[model samples]
Target: MFEWLRVFWQGRIFFLARGDQLPRFLNQALKDGVVLYHTQKSERGMRAQIKLADFRCLRRAARQTHTRVHIVAKYGWPFVAARWWRRKGLLTGFVIIAMALTVLSQLVLSISVSGNRNVISSDVLERAEKLGLKTWAYSKNLDLNQIAKALQEQLPDAAWIGIERNGTDIKIKISEKIRPSIPKEAGNLVASHAGLIKEIMVIQGNPQVHEGETVRAGQVLITQALNPSLPSKTTAPNSAVNNAVARGFVRGRVWYSAEKQILLVEDKVEESGRVATGWGIKFGSRVIMVTTQNSPFEQTNKEVTSPFLQPWRNWSFPVEVIRVNYKELHNVHLERSVVEARQLAEQAARTEVQSKITPMVQIVEENVKVLPSNSGAERVRVEVETYEDLAVYANP
Candidate 1:
């Protein structure tokens, strides 16, 4: 008991000495002034507890005496502390890896865009990136309202865009707007819009435009005049045969445009990042406040959220933590005197022109025409060209 109490902090080790030179090893340990407790003799040799500091001295003595020494047991705080010290680097690395995983789990890792038929998924992803939602972005900092609004502005053809977050994945859903179609009436086929003609498949008519050539709107695409090279192919001046309708479809790159005026100056209140919190309790519309002074900022955007409210048939937790977040706000005046207004107007015009596009139209080119402005805004016209079949008919 006394030896254990004395060596508790310092530590002690029990070792076995085995060899024909056991007596010489013990005598050598004594000569080195090493103390051994619980000494016993066995068939192999001897077993005893030596002070940890003296154990090394005993090992040197045994080596000199040609005896083998094996550790039997270890006890006390020094051994425990030494064992922990040796593995400190491994423990530290484990803690760091755990913390890193926890932080990364709260961020978006994968993004998926779905429910889009006409709009490209990559285009939607690009617009979402502009709205601060992307891979590796902090999921909690994202605002669904802002992302949806940005997508709407960027893709006017999309009727709605929904955003959903699940763990480290963000999924965006889109629904495109359906536009009204034009009523078709049969007559002489003519060019509906100015386009670069790509192909002409005529069953029975004169082809005015060739492949890889530009044509204007209202131009005769498949004229009733069978031989267009002739000065007058019609035998009758005003007969059904002379005014026979064109019979083929003309595929070309047709362009459609829309114009809108953009304001030069924009005014709004912007929110500053600084925020303050206030604690209060709401019991069935009765309020109890812990602090009357909520924020130090002069201008603030205020919001109240109740996290502890009971939703089971309005049954209540009488006391709950009501957090009021006050975000600092500042009045902002913005002017787009440069090309910003023109760019904005062009985006708006593109959105508006989405409704005018016909079926089988594949968009190929997009351009903007900035008209001269003397007023407080700029009038920008955006044109979208598409590859489509222009076979709309007119009176022969």
Candidate 2:
């Protein structure tokens, strides 16, 4: 520790000396209270390292002994810092970057949620944010164990939870509870939507309705109770049927409708082709703008591009160059014909229907009609009929 302190303060230098009286020069230098280390002697000359401040004193000793001294190398932090200080711009940039990184290391930049299926990712992130585990939060203030316990208590469906951090990114990993299958006695199959009963196939229950019958929502299409007195060749004498949970598919035709409206006049934004460019330097959270002129357009779209400084393998500088571009935009009013408005409204109605329907449902028929509106907007109504499974399991 003391040797390191000496190097840090006084620095260290390696020098070569060549003279017949080199031995005398070393003796005199030691006598004058100058320390020498890592001394080596070769056929050509001698090399040794001494404190940079002591080297000045050693020069006088070398002159008294008629020996020539030549500086070979310099080592230690002080010497390296001095070399960098000579280049003012490089030194300023490095200092700014170092300070920025030191500050950024304490703040969080991103939070990611993974390993969730039944529980929504947004729900997990919302909970984390409420607990002060979010982007821009102080990393050192977070307690992983406390946060994990809180999440477990809040989210009963989560079987396991883990919080981990790497640099500015935080990751929340969760293992959701696997819901157990419905017990044979606990659940019953029921209609998920009101529709016509196209077909009924009972796998573990008695059919309650016939094909082509219209059923309302929440009505059961199959009964869980089995008939005991019904005689069958497959059943033994005195054997009774058990009341088990119903399991089967009840496919039906379900009708859905969506309405969309489009205005006869609309405003559309178009690029004006006017662009301006500027450059800036970003030091972590602080950005210094180098451009002198303000943007010329009232409405503009801005884009930024930044480049990283990576000088060596596995090492990179924190400083970056930022380039910005601003593009002008103008809003123009457009008039739409009734036919064009109807087409756009129909397209929007179809999209709305697609969002409402699930992947399991197959659309079988569609009907579209354009209606007159008092608001001067073209209204398009779309009706879709689909053949889909209406069976949904529910606890008895």
Candidate 3:
């Protein structure tokens, strides 16, 4: 074996011969750059492993010498196995990881909603869940368009809906229907409060009063219908009566006021109010608390019911919380200061009476009467009474 190694060490060209001619071939072979090695008689043929260039040279020499040669041992099984494993080792692990990630993403874990105003996120998520899209273990074969169509069919109030996937995450975009504004008519309504008439806008009919006109309640501050067409309907029955068409924008003095009662002594009142943290998160069967216990109001115990999907139907998942703590609070009245009381009373009286009357009239006068109540507390009661001449135009 060592001799065979030395014979082929110096980039030697070796020719393998048939077993029968092994000894004869080895004897005639030269020990130069070109050498010959022959195996003993065995079951398998004598195989040759050589560089392509050397193999060509040996073949040509054998042909010139009229010697028949057979090549064997081109590639051994162990060497071929090692080469195959080396080529595939790195890529095998990568392919396995990719397959695992694909399988995991096939199920929906989370859903996000966007572009919604009137519609709440909870509603969108719930509906999305109902449409077979919110399961933690979900099917990647979900048809987005079908899901959207199903949502619209289920929620008619949703103006538009769309669903898409970002890897394992899902996004649902929705837009709520916007109600159209009702058509306004001139002389429909106006502010009767005693404020300098800042501006008067007439949409449907002509303005009865100008921009800076001080008018009284029931006064024709603006007129959608006019009296000029009345005479034509009686005298000339077939004539066209051009009454101011009552169809436009009517805006005038609008005042807002609120008067609240409070004790002279500041008492610590147990005021219960809902303080929404505006933050909430759901994980599995539990919901982590996001709000702190420092809220000024006592929060009533509430059982929050969240829905989880089981491929198609919803399972009730509720979160129950115990009372944490209570904080001392006082009810602070709005516009209840001594200085603001009088003005608030007057404004309140004016708005209360004006809200009940037609906008065609304005509050020309205002009187706030403050009195004492039986509670031994100073009570401020306002009587806002105003008179305006409203023209009742007959329809032609």
Candidate 4:
């Protein structure tokens, strides 16, 4: 390694020396302190490498010895640099690009969140940004522990939160708090809503009601107790009943109602054919706007386009050209039909009912009604009756 580095720093040249006095020339060159290496005798002449600076002295020695010398090759950084110096502009551009990349590597470009279920990813990212973990933030300026503590304070529901960095990408990992399980021996199953019992399957404890029985909200459908044996009138009954955890599924028919209203008249916007185009240049986080400020239209839809420098590669330049296009828009009053409005209202009603239904519930029957409205708005009402497991655990 040291020899190779030495050769690279002090450029070397390969040359061929011919004639009977080649030996004398070599001796003379050595006497003058010219380093010669890798000397080999060939059929035509002797080939060897000497310091580039010593090549001149070798020519003099070859002339005195009556020997012909010819340069075979040149090698080392100095020669390579000289060759590159011819294309100065390209070299300068490459150097500038390298320096820019070095600076950009320290700045954060994007942030991502993972390992989160109940917590929203955007919420976590927003909190992180507030804590100095946002895009373009210097990596050295951030403290992972401090950011984690801040996030934990804001999201108390998270069991653990961690921040990691990979080049310009920042990753946030979260572990949500685990809810404690309900004890099987300390709760009773009860009806969640008013319904008629359609099926009762007791898995633990004792059953309180049978199928086809009417039950109301908060009514106990299954008891967390052991059944007591029947006692005669003369015999004394047991004072205590074994009250354990009740675990069972009680399916019942439950009803739900949803309503939605739609306006008969509304304003709609339509784009006029006219469009204006403008552009800007973004340097790092700052944008320099170019073109006229005054727009031709009072209302316009604006679109900004900034394409990546290298969309196919993992790394990209921070600089980009932004093009903004504005399209004119005009509003017009439109009258909607009652049938069309009712269809929209019905869709809204069904969405409302679906949002309330749980995984255990199954829809058994549905009914839709269009209400007679004195107001200008049209209203649609939907009634859905479902059969679902009404087993809700409650502390005994």
Clashing pairs in 1: none
Better of 1 and 4 by TM-score: 4
lDDT of 3 at 357: 50
Q: Measured by TM-score, how close is model 3 to the native structure?
A: 0.27
Tens digits of per-residue lDDT, candidate 2, 1-396, equal: 997876777788899989999889989999999999899998878999998778889877888999999899888888887888899998899899999998899999988989877678899889888998988888999997799868865664565688989999988888654343444424566666688998887777778888999997767677665555565556653233434556666789988889999989888898889899888887877778798245768998888887555357876557777777888999988788988999999999999987766533478999998887966589999999998777665433
Compared with the true structure, what per-residue lDDT tens digits does model 3 show for residues 1-396?
876554444333233455455444444444224433443444553444454334555554454455567644343344555566887966688789999888887877778888776567897678777767776746656888898878865553354578878877888887544322223322233333343344555544556666666654434444555547376556443222445444322234533333333333343444454433322445555556556534444433333433332233565434434233333344554334554654554565556665555433345545565665444233455443434222222122
Model 2 misplaced regions, further than 4 Å: 1-186, 223-245, 268-285, 288-296, 301-328, 394-396
Q: What is the C-alpha lDDT of each candidate?
A: 0.77, 0.79, 0.50, 0.79
TM-score of each: 0.36, 0.41, 0.27, 0.44
RMSD of each: 16.4, 18.2, 20.6, 17.5
Model 3 residue 254 CA deviation in Å: 34
Sorted by TM-score, highest first, which candidate order results? Answer: 4, 2, 1, 3
Cα error of candidate 2 at position 224, Å: 4.9
Error of model 2, residue 252, in angstroms: 0.5
Q: Please give the distance, in angstroms, between residue 126's alpha carbon in candidate 3 and its true position after superposition.
A: 1.5
Clashes of 2: 1
- Model 3 local distance difference test score: 0.50
